[model samples]
Target: MTSFADLDLADVEEVAERREELLAAVRDHAGRIAYHIARVDGGDYGQRSFSTDDGEWTVKYEAGDLEYLRFEPRGGGETYVISTQQPAEPKALAEALEDYPAFVAAYNDYVDSLAGMLDSVEASFPQVESTESVVTERDRIVEAIEACCDRMAGELRRYEGTEYGSFAARIDGTRWELKWDEDGASYLRAGGSGGVYVLSQYGPPSAADVREYAPRFGGFVDAYNDHVAELELDLETITFET
Candidate 1:
């Protein structure tokens, strides 16, 4: 995965060209998969199970978006990019279509590689019986961050009419509002300037609760920073210049 810290748009033109090509290829490949689904399911975007050498393979696409491709044995697989339509800009769309063949060949190679891995993996780690849904550490972390952000939003709602420190409620647009909790934790909610916020409790400097929460708060900030790095998003600037 690309990180925000490692992302540099110095070669914007070249990168954009490659991105369009990749997207176009995925869209075309999706159409080919849809063709196979049409034989039985009439090409509708839904799950279709087919027989493979190892076992059954299930492909699913919802609302024209490719969701997942899972094979038998360990029920392991990978998800593909979502594609609905071509870009409105003609030149960019043309660039993507031009690299369609390259994308298809690469995608085929990836599928073949995954199939080989699955065959080997089945011999190495047999499937365990379980009725419970598996929750990974990554999933838990993502959920925690989401819950924290939601709490921040709730705080904004709870204290929108109140004042806190130098921050005041300011509505920029229909859904964009800036406010802070009663405890002085400021928040920029909705619109383009959105981010997670947490309260800083009002009390004496040496308060016991404050000291305890300080490190936890730092951890929360670090988690957000990690998420930003994982996504390769520019926390300071929200724009993509062409």
Candidate 2:
């Protein structure tokens, strides 16, 4: 809850000097340092991180207050975290630096482990085959589905009268329906239950609508075929008769 203004000016100056000293020490040891700061809760929060051949060091602060100083060694050893209400002292910083070499070694080992994991995963994958034949087979099935729909639509059109009429068929245990109204507007439904899907909203279903919707119906047919194939049952293609 302490604000920056509550701190004495001289004390703040001393802390700033110590911070610069710590940064200089880090740069001298690591040859490189990264510092970042952002506004947080109407105050400034910042972090400085630098790496040595041994490990990494991170210093975090809120305004001028030291939040925590952390040192994580490379590879995998114990992480040291120091938290104090006041800024870190020179002795504490020097002690943390002693573990830097261990940290670096641990980190390198971690990287090697990750590389080994990736190599193992890559080895487990089977060789992929060309997809051209798969795509051609899919196109062939879709064309056949479209043809079935077209034949069903043609048969529905041949039914006389504005009165309601419908034709039903069973393919692979699934019932399909093509129903028409007095106006000749047609609907198609798959399965014994569930509402019919209107092929044409404004008018009777057209050859164009059937062609456009064939791919969607082909998806259903494909899934059905896959289900039956998995059960070791014969795959059945949808067919219609007048």
Q: Pick the candidate with the highest TM-score.
A: 2
Question: CA shift at 52, candidate 2, in angstroms?
Answer: 13
Model 2's alpha-carbon lDDT is 0.51
Q: What is the number of backbone collisions in each predicted candidate, taken in the order shown? A: 2, 12
Residue 131 lDDT (model 1):
29
List model 2 lDDT by residue over 109-217, tens digit each: 6446555554545546678898677556555654565455555455445533336666665655666666665544355665656633424344333344444455457
Give lDDT for model 1: 0.44
Candidate 1 at residue 127, lDDT?
72
Per-residue lDDT of 24-97 in model 1, one digit per residue for the tens? 65556665675545444555568755443334445576655466544343244322333343333333333333
lDDT of each: 0.44, 0.51
Q: What stretches of model 1 exceed 4 Å from their correct place?
A: 1-9, 48-59, 62-80, 84-242
What TM-scores do the predictions have?
0.22, 0.34
By summed lDDT, the worst window of 10 consecutive residues in model 2 runs over 32-41
Off by over 4 Å in 2: 1-12, 20-69, 72-94, 105-128, 154-172, 177-242
